[model samples]
Target: MPGSEAIRELVAACVGKVGGPLVALRKIVSAHGHIDDEHVGIVADVFNLSLADVRGIVSFYSDFRTTPRGRRHIRICQAEACQAVGSRRLTREVAEALGVELGATSEDLGVSLEAVYCLGLCASGPCATVDERVVVRVTREELLR
Candidate 1:
């Protein structure tokens, strides 16, 4: 979590900018890892939006998390291109190997498994990312390691 002062500064910096609320929220998530209730309130207040409006934005975007993710985040591409190339099977295998379901963090908090739409590597379908590093034609073995 960032200090209140830092959060305030982040929100203040986006004031009056186009899409300031979304930008501020992204900055908060980038700096603090997640958007908590307090952060929601601060962003709403800073942007003059209703609390519901702010919360709606957070919930609508899969990129925004209300809680912290694990130390290692693994995102498997599930776009039609990837799915056509066996991303579903790959997803299942990775989840089974990691003992964590998609959109969930492991009990030990060491890894979080998530599904994303695409990685812009459609030619190399069934791609995934480990800690933000793209892996084309990723295997369960590679993800587990």
Candidate 2:
């Protein structure tokens, strides 16, 4: 865990950087609960990024955290390109097998499931990323397999 003081300092920075309701929710949950969401609203308000801009940023980048992430983030590509192969089935299987929602991680701290438009590995057709690292081909079995 990040040191409390360090976390507090970061939180202060975040507050200064982002004073929106979404950011406030992030702070509240960070100080209280163990999870939060990818706060697009907060990011927009903080940077004065437009809603469209924020949505684009959030949608284009899978690395941004809207909520508190689990130990690991499992990002699957649901873009037309990836799905053209078999990413759709793979996504459903991962979510179902993990017993969690698309944006949720398992209770075991093993993985969190998410959908991405493209992983920039279009050649791979069916690609996914793990924690902003390890872009690789994925199948339903391979995901939970």
Assess every candidate by TM-score: 0.94, 0.58
lDDT of 1 at 139: 80
Candidate 1, 3-59: lDDT as tens digits: 988998999999988989989989998999989999999998888889999999999
How does each model score on lDDT?
Answer: 0.91, 0.63
Q: What is the Å distance of residue 140 in model 1 from its true position?
A: 0.9
Candidate 1 colliding pairs, count: 0
lDDT of 2 by residue, 13-122 (tens): 65554444345335534553332233444445555667677566545544445455666777888888888888888888778878888978677767778787776788
lDDT of 2: 0.63
Q: Which stretches of candidate 2 lie over 4 Å from their true place?
A: 3-62
For each candidate, how many residue pairs have backbone atoms clashing (under 3 Å)? Answer: 0, 8
